[model samples]
Target: MAILTRAGRIELANAIKQKSIYLAWGQGAIEWDTQLPSEPSSSTELTSILGYRKATRVLYCDADEQGEIQVPNGRYKIVAGPTPHLYCQFNYDFNDGLSKSIRELGLMVGTKPKASTPSGQLYFQPEDIEQKGTLLLLEHRPAIYRDQGVRESFEFVISF
Candidate 1:
C-alpha cells in the first residue's frame, strides 16, 4: 500500500489555506420542548441555518507528539508542519443571530460572488446569503439561546 508522506500532507494543508472558508450556524430539529437536539450521524448540509460568516482567522499549525495543536500566532498566516492541522476562528457580534437558538455549526467552503462587496452587499445576518457551499465540518450540541447583548465566538481545529 502506498503511504502519504509528511511533505505531501503539508502540501495539502497549504492548499486548504488558500480557500475561502466560512462558519455557519443552524437550529436543528428538537424532539420536544424538553429534549436537546442530537447530531445526525451523517449530513450533507445543515438542517436549518441561521447565518454564515467568513472566518476571522485561519492558519496551518503543528501538533505535539500527543496530537495536541500548539498555540498559533493570532495573525492570519500559514505555517505547515509535519501534521496537517487547520485552525479556524469565527466571531459573531452581539447583534448577529439575536434571540435565536443555535444547535448546529458547520465549516463551509464557497466562492464570494462578485455582487458581494463589503459596502454593497454585506453578509452579517441569515438573510444576507443563501447556503451555497460544500459543508466540510459539522458539530451538534445543546442549543445556545442567543441574546441581544451577547456575542458568540468559536474556535475549531480540523485535522486533515
Candidate 2:
C-alpha cells in the first residue's frame, strides 16, 4: 500500500489553483431523467454544453475551513490548517442559458482562447473557445429550467 504525504497534497492543490478554471453548464439530453449515464471520471467534456465562465473566486485552505477565507481584506485573521482543500465559486448571468433546461455541470481546467476571441471576455459560449479543457469535475441531475430575470450561482469544494 502507498500513502501520499500532506505536503504532496498541498503542492497538488496549489498547482490546480494556478490554472485557469471554469464552470460549464449544459442542457444534456431531454431524456436525462431516465437515461443519463453514470458520471465517467474520464469524461473530457459535458454531454452538451450551453456555455461556461471563469470561476468568480478560488480559495486555498485547510480541512476545518480555516487557513484561508475570502472575506474583505484585513477583516479576519488567517490560519493554515492541517489538510488541504480548494473552494471555487461561480456566478451566471441572468440571460445565460435562459429558456433552457440545464441538467449537467462541469468544472474545466486549462481552457484556451480562440483566435477571434475578444479581449477580456470572461463568459463564453461553446463556439467562442478553442479547447474545452480537461473535465476536472462532472455533475448530472434533474433538469432545472431557466427563466428570464433569474440568475444562478454554484460553489464547489475540492479536497486534495
RMSD of each: 4.7, 5.1
Which residue runs does candidate 1 get wrong by more than 4 Å? 32-42, 64-83, 111-117, 120-127
Poorest 10 consecutive residues of model 2 by lDDT?
Answer: 70-79
Error of 1 at 6 (Å): 2.0
lDDT of each candidate versus the true structure: 0.71, 0.79
TM-score of each: 0.76, 0.84
Candidate 2 achieves a global lDDT of 0.79
Residue range 63-133, candidate 1, lDDT tens digits = 44444433332322345543466888888878777888888898887735344546533234555554457
Q: Model 2 off-target regions past 4 Å?
A: 34-36, 65-83
Write one digit per residue (lDDT tens) for candidate 2, span 23-125. 9999988889787778987788898899888899877644332433443221222234333567778988888888999999999988876879888777899
